[model samples]
Target chain A: MERKNFLRTFALVAATGPMIIDGCKKDSATKSTTSTTGTTTSTTTSASSGCVVTPTETEGPYPYVGGEATNPLNRVDVTDGQTGVPLSITFLVVNTNDNCNVVSDARVDIWHCNKDGYYSGYANQPGLLGSKSYVGETWLRGYELSDSNGAAKFTTIYPGWYGGRATHIHIEVYVNSVMKKTSQVTFLETISDVVHVSTLYAAHGVNPVRNASDSVFGDSATDLANEIMTLVGSVSAGYAGTYTIGLAL
Target chain B: MYKAKIKLVYKQVIDASSETSFEKAIIHASYQEFLLKSQAYNAEGKFKTFSRMKANDGRANSLHYKLSFSVLHFIEQLDNKIPVIKDNLGNKLSFDTAAFELIESHIEDSSLHKVAINYQTETLTLIDFMGDYLLLTSADAKSNEPSETFVVKMQPGLSIMNYQEINQFAINNLQLETP
Candidate 1:
C-alpha cells in the first residue's frame, strides 16, 4: 500500500489532557483519534504544497486508524505483552501556524512493528510477519493525548524494522477527530543499528535497510528528520526522547 | 446526513457443553464487526451515513468502536442479510479464538447498554459494545447482496484487507470468560 493512499480523516478518540511537551513526566500519555462522522470531511489542512503541518505521509497499512478504544496502558506504555528493551517515547503537538507553540487537546496515535518485525492486528503480512496474520493483538501500539503543554508520553520497546522502511513509528497528531498532521519518527542510524542487532530484533531478521536506503526517507530525508526525536538514553536500560510535531492547523 | 455507524453486539450464549464454536463466534463476529465499522457503503459509493448507534455517554463509550454478534451457525444462517462479522475475503485465519477469553468484563447495570470486554491478561480491549448501530440489518427479505460484496463502494476503490492484525490484537489478549 502506498503511503499516500492511507486515509487520515478518521476520528481520534484517545485520552487527552494538558501538559508541556518538553517536560513530559514519566508515565504521562495523551491519546488521539477522530470521530466516525468527521471522516467525510477533510480535517487535514495541508495540501501537497508547502503546508507547515508535519508532512502528510501515507497512514501505512496496519493502523488501528478508526478504533476508539484505549488500552489501560495505551497512554503511558504499550509494551504490556511484548518483549524487548524498554523505550519511552514522548511527543509534543504544536500549531505551526501559531508560532509553533504547544497546542493542547491534540491527540497522537503511535504504532510500530513488534521486535520480530511484525505488526499486530494484521494477517498474511509480507517479510517476517509471516503468512499467518495476528489481527487484534495490540502490543507495541498505544495512544496519548497531550497535556497543557502539548505533551504525550508513551512507554514501549524501540521499534524494529520492516522490508521497506527503516526502524520507525507511525505517528498521527490530530485536533480532536481532524488529523492536523501525519508523519513518522526514527532513531539515528547508529542507534537503530544497536536496536536491530539486539537479541530481540536480530534473530527474527529485521530490515537491514538504513534510513538513506528507505525510499520514503530517502525522498524526504530532511522532511522526515524535521520531526525526528531527540533521544537521551541507551538501547539497553531503555531510551527516552521527545518530538515536537508542527501542524498548520 | 451522518451515516449510522454499524454497531457490533455479541451476547455471550455461554454454552456449558461449549460444544460448538462459541468463542470462535465472538472472534468471527468481531472480524465482521470491524469490517462494517471500518468500511461502509452506498450504491452510489459517494454517500455516507454518520449516525452510528450510541451506547452511552461514558469514558469507555467514546474510546472504542462497537462489537456485537451471535454464534457462528446463527450468524451464517442469517445468510449475511444482516451486517454480521466475517473475514470478507474468506481469509479464515489459522489462529483460534478459544485461546482467548473476556478476562475483564466491566458490567454496567445503569442500563443493559454499555458493555466493555477486555482480555484478562493484557491491556488490550476486545469488544466495546457501547451501543452503536445495534440493529444494522433487519431480518427482512431485502434482497441486496450483503455489504461484504459491495467492494465497489469503497471510495478509493481500496479493498478491506484481512482481519489478522485487528483480530489477533484482540485474540492474543482473549481468555475464556468463565461463568
Candidate 2:
C-alpha cells in the first residue's frame, strides 16, 4: 500500500511539472520574438519633441488714430471710420483660471458704426446715406494692450441702428499677443427712440429706423440694449453712452 | 543558413493648413517616440523553442521592451493628429483636432516570424513567416539561390493644422496685412 501511494504521488508531480515547464517555455518563446522584432522604436519622451521654439520680432502697418485718442470712442473712429460723438466702452480681460487680471500686455481691438449710420473708410454706395469705410477694411480694427488692472477701453461713435437688428459693436481680445476671445456689445432700442426724438440721431442724419434694417447689422447685432445709457440732458449735442465688458481669459 | 528580406513602408499627409515649422516639430516628435519604444532582442545564445511567446509577457523582459517600443511608435504616429501652428518665425501655436494613427512594426522574415501592426490612422501588413524556404536544409540545397521574399504595407493618416492658428501666427510674425 505504501509503495502504491508513493507511485501515485510521483505521477501527479510529473504531470504538473511538464505543464508548468510548458507554460514558461511558451512565455519565453514569445519574449524572444518580440525582443527580436521590437528593437524598432521608442515612445517615452516623444511628446516633448513636439515643442516649437519661435523667434521674437516686431513688424506692423498699424492702423491710424483720429480725434481724442485718450477716449475709447475716438480710438474707434480712427479704427472703424466712425465719426461724431464717440461711444465709451470698457471691459475686463481674464484668463483660463477665471483671473480677471490677465497681464499688462493683453491687446484689445474694437470697431463699430458712425453717427450718420455708416463706416468712414468704406466707399459710399450711390443710394446709401453715408460713405462706406468699415466694409471689409480692418485698418481701424486693431489691438491694444490691457492695463495692470486687466482693463481695456475703446472710444467709438454709437453705431446707428441698421437692418432691423439692434445696434451693437464688435470686439476682440488678445492675451500676450495671442487672440483669446471675440464678442459684441448691444444698445437698447428704447434708447434709440429717445435719441431719435431728442434729435441726437437727426444731428448725425442717422435714421435709427433705417439702420435697424441693415442685413449685416441684423445678423451681427448682440444684446447691448440694456447696457446703453445716454448722458442725461445732452439732447442738443451728439449722444454719449458707455459699455462695460467683463471677460474670461 | 536561413535568409530573409524585410521592407519598411510609411505614409502620412501634412495638413494643408499646417505651417512648415509645425510639421517639422511633429516629424521630430514621431522619430523620438519611435526610438524610445522599439526594443532589441538577443537570441544569439538562448535555446531554441517550438512554440512562440507573446511579446508583452513580463517574464520576457527583453521582448517586452521591444513591444513597448512598437507601442510608442504607434503613439507617436497618432500624436500627429494634434494640430500645431507656428509663426513663420517659428513660434509654437496651439490647435485641436479629431483623430490620428500610428504603426510601429510590420516585419516579415523567412523564419515564419510575421508581424503586422495597425493603430490610429495607420495600417501595417506583413506576410511569409517560418517556411520551408527559411530552413537551413532548404538553404543548403539551394546555396546559390535567392532568399525568401516578403511584403509590408503602411497607410498613415493626414496630419491637420488649424487654419485660424496659422492665420494668426502669420499675421503676428510676418507683418502680413490683417484680413
**Which candidate leads in TM-score?**
1
lDDT of 2 by residue, A195-244 (tens): 54444456534354433354544543353332334343333454455444
True contacts kept of 1: 0.00
Q: Can you give the lDDT of residue A77 in candidate 2?
A: 36
Model 1 chain B: ten consecutive residues of lowest lDDT: B119-128
**Candidate 1 DockQ category?**
incorrect
Docking class for model 2 is incorrect
Model 1 iRMSD vs. native: 12.9
Give all TM-scores, in the order shown.
Answer: 0.46, 0.33
Q: How accurate is candidate 1 locally (lDDT)?
A: 0.48
Error of 2 at A16 (Å): 99
Q: Summarize candidate 2's per-residue lDDT along B1-179 as a digit string, tens digits.
A: 22222222222343223344434333343333222222122122122211222233334333322222222322332233333322233432221211223322222221222222221211111123343211111122122446443321211422212111123343344443323
